[model samples]
Target: MGLEFLDVFEQWANSYDESVGGQNREYKAVFAGYEQILEAVTERSMGHVMEFGVGTGNLTKKLLDKGLNVTGIEPSVPMRGIAEAKLGSKEIILDGDFLHFPDIINVNTIVSTYAFHHLTDKEKNEAIAKYGKLLSKGGRIVFADTMFESVEDYTNAIVKAREEGFHNLAKDLETEYYTTIPILRTILERSGFTVGFKRCNDFVWLMEGEKQ
Candidate 1:
């Protein structure tokens, strides 16, 4: 699954920013969530930030404008190339997934947008634990992505996707795993984080967990 997804992204890397879902009406909802997330992060005083899956550098460009130092982790070679082009040749973008991205230290914030669902549930927990360990004291993770309440909810979402003519998307959803708010909160709390969440809509959510 990982290699397959990677191949798909590699193929789409050059045109991702102009893809159907990237700038179409279908993306308005995601853009709205991105705006809210930018606002939320801007209100806080975050020092060093690590962003995983920095696809196409849309959000990374905004963070750079805020004068924040960001380290990006992306596995796709072509995608990383595009991101580096957007962020400039010097900005550091490590070529690995979150679990394997190296040399991270003293990071105050770790953020990912619409990325983690690519991971299995066990991998999600593992990534959360890694985030807890990598961050400096009082550091937090601000994750914005598609989240569901349960497997049933995920199933319903898949059904809706198919009904909306997103058959391929629905098919992909069958194999991908997404975490729920309750499960995510429990995992973070167990890992010594104080958790908070906001629902952006039926499918998208923002979760923050500050290390204690």
Candidate 2:
């Protein structure tokens, strides 16, 4: 059978929280920068907030703490369970996939953290179209995840993994979906979003667009 993003993630369910989902305290501290980006997005946002792939609510507390009305879409049952458990009775935790949600929510803006990169190119493009179609006029989307900086990073990672006998770690590091900046920007543009910014580390991006 063909591989799916959810499939691989499901297999990594146990490690999902500790690895990159920001469940651990150290991970959360390291991810503080991304949280700042999400906060800025929330502050500038004019309407509702929707998260397409909210894994374990790493950013959930930050968003909810702001008292912003936010909803999230997650496909992994285990991950969803963790998130729902943390966000009890909030009613915003919906068990669904971003590209195949049964209901449509037209909001002012949408944001996600570290989740979009898991999707395949086809699903990513489809999601842009599907979600963009649901954006209210003047709405926007802002998200940040791994954006590839160099092919050498992939090569070096693989090489290091082989030397260290850490195949699983290497495989997980392969999620540099937005290999180049322009490619992702082009896709978003075609889907009616003007590229705001795409940044990493101390860098930050605020690519957004009005529903046209």
TM-score of 1: 0.88
Q: Residue-wise lDDT of candidate 2 within 48-151, one digit each (tens)? A: 77877777776666677777778787777777777888777447877777566657455767777666666666767788887678886678777766554455
Best by TM-score: 1
**Which residue pairs clash within candidate 2?**
196-207, 197-205, 197-207
Question: By how many angstroms RMSD does model 2 differ from the true structure?
Answer: 4.1
The superposed Cα distance between candidate 1 and the true structure at residue 205, in angstroms, equals 0.5
In model 1, state the lDDT of residue 103.
85
In candidate 1, position 65 carries an lDDT of 79
- Each prediction's TM-score against the native? 0.88, 0.76
